[model samples]
Target: MFLNNLFSKIFRNQNRIEYTTGKAVPLEEIYLSELEKYPIWIYALEEEDVEGQDEFWVKPITNSTNVEAELSTPYILLKIKENNCPVSALLDIENMKLDDLQYWDYKYGNWEELNKLDMPSPIHLISIPSILGKPAVEFSVDIKPKNQTTAIARTLMGPDECKDMYKTLPPNICPVCHTPLKREINPNFIVSNKRSCLRYTYDSFCIVTEDFKNFCTLNHYPNLEFKEFPKSPGNYYFTPLNIFPLDPIRQKIKFEECCSSCGGFKGAYGSSPGFKSKNFTLPSNDFIYRSDIEFGSEEKKSPLIMVGLETEIKMKKFGLKGIYFDDIYE
Candidate 1:
């Protein structure tokens, strides 16, 4: 009943954190590093006795399905323990077939592995999705400890012992810190002008505010590219490999005044503004000066380009990094 009581108190509860625009600094301002890795989510369950006593009789319910196929994704069933004996932990029956039995004794590290066990005792039914993206139906089961010795022997000593235990990967991570990203769905509006804060969620867990920002990618040079200057007048640098002068190493330690065609020093020995230019102009004039410039026009019959650009024009004006595309049209 404690599980039922705790579940009723916390489920569907929402927490909020407020951040102001402009008042808050960019994530890059705090951390200069980029987000190079993906993040993951974690879930755990509790094992205990029926009356919230130390004696455990609850057996973890393990189930699987193979109605359409020979095997299905596995789901763990949790139960309380009492006197080193096992009590029932059953799930509701449905269109799917359930099999396989594995007992995990937190009291002991080794799990009692069974190939195929009998159907579980049904209690309450829940429709949860399988890891393989299939529909899953589960039944809750009560437990009865098999022994009187270790059932009272316990390790997880707090109310936090009960929880679902599983893990999965989320797509993004904090550009600064590499912690798993969480979601805040339709959270309270912290900033008066904004309707929602940027957040990510998995199941009932979330990464909010500071945690939310950590999951976003820091794009320093998302649109960066290098072009070639003619080695000799009339000769063109076409392929990526053919353009050796454009290489990172060769591009460094440069002489400014050289023939645009021959790329040799004959005129001035000083660096020219035109020697190398950054934030190059794309072929499309309409997309000029946009940090998040789109590549082709819809009427022009070319591939459409989309990239993450700053929402504010001031950021774009200050040369903020963002996504861009080039025209592939003749």
Candidate 2:
């Protein structure tokens, strides 16, 4: 049995492509587009197979909660067919489910015997798309050695690993051509507004323009008053909108800005730089700039004022047309 196992190891090694040979291409040069054309295989191991293997079970401290307690030992392997061979092509299992009874039987019932076989046997194959979708290119194998267990350490692959592998690939290389892709932006897309302001505070007297009046009416402001503007024939004064108090002892101030037409939250600015602005489209077809001042106080009741300004420009849409990856020699 020992002699037979030794010969089997030698045979497997001989079949594997040697790194010294020019035919052995770097895994990074292989793109998902090209890989999708060919079938791949995922090797699932039983939980018992990974027991006593720290490398397989150890979780990184930063991602302990995110990592799955059970490692999906689905190691991906590409299936290559030999030319003019009488043997039948490997069966594609891309659509096969891991939980299927037939798959379970095939994996456990015959895997042991196949592993013990002295001669090369057929390998079950699947596709990357079936397992990972188009984002399969963003994943790679992460292997570490601990007590001789080479099982994958994490179930999910991170973008950093994928980026590191394809470092030689151009930053903007087209997935197919291996050349830089051109990026064009269309400056006409309307921004989708999705945030709401519950309350707001301003330090100075607020001007109620016609736009402001329309905004208040659309937003169901019950207390707002509209007065004809003396300076303009068609403009009106918007008043009584909720405003934050300029109290020196107030710890925080908040406000909401609704769209004049849709009553949606247009955008908002706060004293704190950490405030997140909600999605909003420009009130007018053209770009506009708005500014406001916020008032508050320090712990000792020292008066504080913060000026905030925002420029809402038309949304810009980007398109990727011409790009390519560096030439890959197999």
Candidate 3:
């Protein structure tokens, strides 16, 4: 059956050769809103974009960081440092309705409605990842970084095509991103024996392990789907089916550019989907929820996936490697 499906697969129109590589550049510096005394004002480098945002709020018990290495930069560089303030912060606007968070207009010298395009980074982290007071929400899982043993299979159409190449991981809509760039995906990503699990990039990418797939199936966590790779039986192109809408403004979400043909956002989310509130209802154990916002740029466009507490505990108890959770998203 696998061979029949593979051979019958129709190759889509090939455009340019694949060149999207998901990589993280060094962050200019660490940023957090908790230490600031004044309103958050990012985008200082550009005067036209000079504006004050409602600081992203976090009722934290404490704060900390383990980002000893590099981090994903704001696609356009937002970690601006002022003389009085080391790092300017955005408004603490997460989960709150649009009418809630306002913008500070420098010209009028009065707070006004914020446009979605002008929203700043939502949550800043320098403390414990897990919210101590929350009922059962935990911080991010520890997905292993991409290393020597990892073999990244992409859907980005290359000059030389193979069975592994695809237009989307599920052989359907590329659910993770909203890029204007033409993209072809390899849904059947293969993994190596060296690592128990894999990933060097952010969790936005829908890559996963065979064990994870089995665990989901056995546990009846239905929102996730998987496509196994024949070349490497242990690997799979994993994707989540459930979705939740994202607030483009307050979360630093928007399209830097857009593709004319598709009218899609030109790339994936510049920053991860971060919010400091847990005001929404969690999905049941049978499913997980993905933000309507997708992350990654040309190389990859995917959503930030969030699972409920039940799913989190099950995965932890099952001993899934390279998987972690964060308490940031709404």
Candidate 4:
């Protein structure tokens, strides 16, 4: 059966690869209002390791990197540093909405009738990928309400509330340089799952298994296993769940390649377009660590599940690696 299916699949168009799951919602069904509230910004601090010049690092974070690739949606760059200040003119706009949303909350200070904006709005992480594309450590943000029917907000009424809408994180320091954490920081909303099972409720690990099973069953692959990887909080990206976990290790091997900045949990290794390496290596040490620790524990509070790796032997009759974001749409 697998061989028959594989041969028939050869003729399928790779343009849009269909998933085991059904199609996602229609474009019109989602709007800016339906997306997460705050935009998710990606801050990247980088040094080119050029010859001769003393290595100068951007303290905290700075806008010096270049954009590589973007997923989820796209937005524009608005160079304004003003956070809480009211956006008075249309030119004050920075980013635009790319996907649809269910609802949104907006707040604007003063100029009550003219400056106010609100509603169940769609949002976007506007300057994220572009900022990531720079040479300096840039602060990328996505401001929702990218698309609105009116400028005067109907949701989140009142002065203090309006001020809250523009609130920033790590307050008072330039989010990039510790000058001030401005209201301009990316805004986001929380998505909660109430399922009680460790595998279903607490962790998104099942996603890995489902993807693996689909590929193995359809492609007749072999020796496939899921491995855990690190998660990047700022990017809101987690490693695939449903992989094996290494037993805690004592007297673990240490390395000299540590970040000059924050040590321990805060240290850095290497980074790719979407992920940053953890300071320490996984005990499994195997290029691929495989495990399946289900979620469900009441102890978990973080929204992101630990990342994991997926591996299959070269001899495996079937199976594939690296699920593409575009695959979801296909």
Top lDDT prediction, candidate number: 3
lDDT of 2: 0.22
Global lDDT scores for all candidate models: 0.22, 0.22, 0.35, 0.22
**Highest TM-score scorer:** 3
Estimate TM-scores for all models. 0.15, 0.16, 0.42, 0.18
**Candidate 4 structure quality by residue, lDDT tens digits, 1-330:** 000112222222221111111212211112232222222212111222422111111111123222323321222222223332211111111232221111111321012111123423221222322333443222323434333331111100000000121223333332222222121222342222211111211212222333334543464433443332223121121133223232222213122332233221211221111221233343321122222221112121112222212222220223222221100000
How far out, in Å, is residue 272 in model 1? 91
> Candidate 1 lDDT, tens digit per residue, 186-212?
222121111112111122221112211
Query: Candidate 2: misplaced stretches above 4 Å?
Result: 1-205, 241-330
Error of 3 at 148 (Å): 34
Candidate 3 lDDT score at position 115: 27
Superposed by TM-score, candidate 2 places the C-alpha of residue 79 at a distance from the truth, in angstroms, of: 40
Please give the lDDT score at residue 326 for candidate 2. Answer: 12
TM-score: the better of candidates 3 and 4: 3
lDDT, candidate 3, residue 69? Answer: 11
The local distance difference test score of model 3 is: 0.35
